[model samples]
Target: MAKTKKLAFICYPGQETFIEPIVREYEKRPQYQVHRYYTDQQADVIAAVKWADILWLEWANQLTAVATQVYEIKSKSVIVRLHSYEALSSLPTRVNWKVVDYLVFVAPHIRDIVKMQIHDIEKQVCTKIIPNGLDIDNIPKNKVFNMYDIAYVCNLSLKKEPAMMLQIMAELVKFNPAFHLHSAGGWQDKGCEIYMKHMAKEMGIEENITYYGFVENMETFWPGKGILLSTSFHEGHPCNIMEGMARGLRPVIHNFIGAKGLYQEKYLFNTVVDAINMITEWSATTPDEKDYRKYVIDRGWTKKSMMASISKLIRLCGKKA
Candidate 1:
């Protein structure tokens, strides 16, 4: 009989983008059998835990109930990946570190912030900074052109600070009359959506702004964009930034504390004027698309590289625990 390592991933439903790639990678390997469990019912969660040798709770919040069930998680090696929003939630304080052998944070700043909030438990757990896998292999490198159409990827919610992009665009237009802002991703609330449109018109930049509601396939959407701009106040290393870089878009990331650690310092910005300047500078040149793509792949952020590392981590952690 062939030896098989059973793995169960319990994730919050909306985060399928992160989970799907890993699951696909595992399925390709004969040595692994993967099961996906969403945190819905207590009984189902327990059954899923019982079936797997390794259990990776995709969000710390998924462990809110499972952490309390000492017996259920006792036999399985538990690892939890914490994103930025969950670092602020009650879930961090509630995780049973004795049961969870490892904690994975998407960004170092998120790990640091959550450690401050969770206190004693943070010290007890072995943690690793793991970015969610991104594959640009299928995304052909159609490097940027000097003409201006700035793209910001992520949900158009209040938290992502889409309004900040508008503020930056207002400044960019004063210099580059052709500059436009493309906002893509689901708008969480209709009220927030309505407000953004109203605010853009009020600021007299409505024609320059376009809201693309929930991009279904990025391969179709990411091509030939001028620059990838992020105005998020908080992030766990935004995927849009990585996707933008992979698609050969110049990244203009508003400094979200530790984003400078993730990208070159030159790409980091503090003010709308700085963002406008970066946008203009990139527009006026031919960015080294090969360098950006290589940088992402070099960091082991690609689907295959990250999956291989993740499998190694799970097995190693399981053995150590």
Candidate 2:
């Protein structure tokens, strides 16, 4: 029998939700043997790097001293997954870009921005654009469209612009009293928490807003909601938008990088007032739910689409069973 190829994934401790599911899916195949190591522990991380045929790291900030040690020890290819937060600022000079064989971006706009910032397009590094994918077969279908509720699933961070979402909901309440907003996801910084609480109270929309922090099953919270809103300043193909659309919820997103190609003019907004208008208009119109579901499934959220991309990436690394 042929030996299974060993693969090591190095990431921060709390990122298991994002990384684990993908790793688990890949490991199901008989050709691969996967091991996960948290970068928080230096010695264990280094040991895992030395033992694997491939190194996969998540987030630019999470790459610390341990990441450098991995590059030094491992002759295997290195792949870094870049998110929106990493592209917002400058990267450290000692990142050892030469060690990276491939850099994957979740959106094309993010890839463009990073290339402009680095200014070395001629470098030997390979860049791939792979948007976040959802398990469409598992997502429950919400047959009924309840116009009373709207939901936003993301971390309550400043860059996510939760304050703007609160303001939009505040204005929406006057026009439609039954309008309710549901929020889920964790808070990273103190400022984000304080701002979220202050805005909810100040806008007098606290009664209508339901906070379900850090949910494990977004499928339950996503369905039955009439419209989904994303007011982020930036994003690398947000999972929330994809998941919401899969559940037959219409999406109203700000004019950001990843959203440009996915939605139409009716769903795109440039400002708070624009967002309010767009949401209100979407809520009023009763579009065909089947059409919405079909759109999401066709655009890389289906099981087949995700597996094809993953297989392509694995093959690109020159690994064999």
TM value for model 2:
0.91
Candidate 2, lDDT over the whole model: 0.76
Every candidate's lDDT: 0.77, 0.76
Deviation of model 1 at 54, angstroms: 1.4
Candidate 1 per-residue lDDT, tens place, 65-140, comes to 4643758677678888777788777777777777777888887888878867766666688888877667666767
Off by over 4 Å in 1: 62-64, 67-70, 143-146, 317-321
Q: In candidate 1, where is summed lDDT lowest over 10 consecutive residues?
A: 61-70
Candidate 2 local lDDT, 66-147, one digit each (tens): 4755555447767777777777777623356666777777778887777767777327467787777777888866877876
Superposed Cα deviation of residue 310, candidate 2 (Å): 2.1
Query: Could you say which candidate leads in lDDT?
Result: 1
